[model samples]
Target: MRSPQGVCLFSLNFPPEPTGIAPYAGALADGLSKAGFSVTAHVAHPHYPEWIIADDYGQWTRTEERGRTSVRRRLHYVPRTPRGYRRLLSELTFGLRLIFDNWRYPAAIVSITPSLFATALVALRLRLTPNRPPLIIWVQDLYGVGLAEVGEGSSLVQRIVRWIESSTFRAADHVVVIHERFNALVTQELGVAADRVSVIRNWTHLADPPNTTAVQARRQLGWPADVILAVHTGNMGAKQGLENIVDAARLAEARNSSVHFVLVGDGGERKHLESLANGVSHISFVDPLDDHDYHLALSAADVLVVNEKPGVASMAVPSKLTSYFNAQRPIVAATDRAGITAEEIFAADAGLVVPAGDPEALLSAIQSLCADEQAAERYGKNGRQYRDAVLGEPAALAKWSDLIQQKFRDSNQN
Candidate 1:
């Protein structure tokens, strides 16, 4: 069935991209379509964690039906800078490529962030076309801050990108941020009006019942029965302050031999992290697993980790918190700014938040749970309750569907 309003969703990275936002985009597309909105997802070929294009997608031209959603993939340049510069190039190319690809369809648009180029281009098109549909710019990561963190671009380029990003934010008919802190940044830093912006918290997909039997999971991963399993799943990059985790592992080992730390997933800092823990028996490094396996690993973990660099508050919001919440495990967030995720976790009594990059603090938080089984159970239950109440798939879909359809209706009147 054709949609009442043609709403096209554009994202730099979509499904098979091996990260949070991609899958989130794909899911949103499916959800929006099921709500009776015609959804066409425009994205670049999958190429994330590895920084190279995925082999299966070839150079270009891949399409799939995700429920009622239509996904269109296109070819774009992937840089070899091995850091932020390459990522900037990827976003730029995908943005430019999508302009033509999405020209005729999609009466309204919603864009995910850090893809400043994509958002800016869509904003520009809307500005130029008087009768064009309204655009919603979803701010996930603040682009200017993220680029500087990874050591990308010249002062001039950073200045220009910031300009483009700010202009895009201003251009959007509505700007949505994942948390209150980010919403404030858009208003104070970028000068977006409070009335024009909304704080839409991120949500987790409805999770399956926990695997009551992790005997298979434990056997497959060789997790020791006696050891306290501490797992860090997600990107292994500089921004994550993974070295702090390695140091925490050392401290955990020094404090208790039975506490084991496992690092799963790959990124720019993988080699250095592996090298640091080379001879260490307590800290284990495993290859990145698929979503199902990742979920299983989280369930098997005694404590889950989220970390950030010192003084890097507002630089990023870890997308893994949703997964952690869904996994219903006690989380230890080591972030300089414990924004919404940390606040909610604490309020729900689901986890402990420590200052970012402080190995001693992280070590202490992990030990708190290691020593108290009742506290762990309480925290885990709180997390599950929080997830069910706020971040579940149905809640998110209902909110998104209303917002998108409202935009579609408004666009039609215009």
Candidate 2:
């Protein structure tokens, strides 16, 4: 028998959830298993972006195996609607369950934050144990700040959340951050030491896309031959500030511009956005595509998009960025210059950045890309090259395995 993998991961998100951090989490677990560490993931029922338990998830809890890794998905309370208090209650219910649950084998615990409170419980519980597992709190998204970013939560709520965050940060032996800006916030703003954090840029799900031309894709997608196609795929949630995209589309339609906007994916704000987009002929929404079509659409598009509302910086890095890069298309990001999305796009020289929450500016950027073919092609090439170098699978997966060895295996031996 192979050496038992001394790692256990606790997180609310996992695969078959459609969007958010599930794909990334699943990728990590799968990679770890392939690298010869038997992994166990306590996956909570999927209740993200859409905020409802998917009908097919079935019953309270069940255990399944993903290759060598075993996954247990528990039934947690899912609020009928996605709201702050309801979400908090769900975390409380799930965290408490995990806290009281058995740990027959001790291993270095890897807990993720989204339900930051749940991770806090694990951190606190580990502290009370005599032989505490070396804890690693994975920072995928900043929760308290994210709530405020989407125009939810109050000052009191934020304070309580931050207190939990600070406590958990202190509790973990090492805090892993996927984006550099997150590292800055944790150390400079949250009072954590700089040395305690590790940055591993996320790996992509879309790789070595079949070389396809936009003209051919437009034909397959049943789009007009002359219009420019700009597509934004992934979750259509509040934080995305999709209204800006809709408004820009409306303006473009009014001006009879050649540029067209298409949004693909589902989320809480999708219905509301559909209502907002009712009369705009140039703007259209498509349901989530199958993998083959998704890749085709991405590779075929003239441009990709990443948008965020104003005053919403440092909370999320938009997991869609990896997919955008893999699509080999230049993008237009309408987000704060201070945000990670803007920083990464500019650093990769992947696309153009416009003022956050400005429909007029978004329209201008889209038009300019349509107007200049050479500049757009250059950006596309640069992004594809950067994705291979930085976000490529071999590099990211090796970094994760190295982390497991350094933080989990090495510490165990000593």
Candidate of highest lDDT: 2
Residue range 1-414, candidate 2, lDDT tens digits: 113366787888887665678888888888888887778888787766567787778467788987777888888887755556777898877888778776546456778887688998888888897756678888988876786776677888787877778778977888888888899888876667888788988888655787678777777877666878889888887788899999999999889888889898877788899999998998888877766788878877888998887878889888888888888789999999878889899888999999888999998998898689899989988898888888888788798788767775555665
The CA lDDT at 311 in model 2 is 78
Structural similarity to truth (TM-score) of each candidate: 0.91, 0.93
In candidate 2, which residue pairs clash? none
- Assess candidate 2 and give its TM-score to the true structure: 0.93
Best model per TM-score? 2
Where model 2 places Cα greater than 4 Å from the true spot, the runs are 1-4, 223-225, 409-414
Model 1, 1-414: lDDT tens per residue?
Answer: 224557788887787765757777877887778877788887778766655677777556678877788878888887634465676677777777777664454656888886787677767767877667778888888877665655557888777877777888998888888878888888998888999898777778535546644456676667776777888877777778788888888887777657788888777788889899877677998876777777778878888888776655666667787777777778888875445546666766788889887888888888878689888877878888877787778777788777776776776776
RMSD of 1: 2.6
Misplaced by over 4 Å in model 1 are: 1-3, 80-82, 147-159, 213-216, 253-256, 337-341
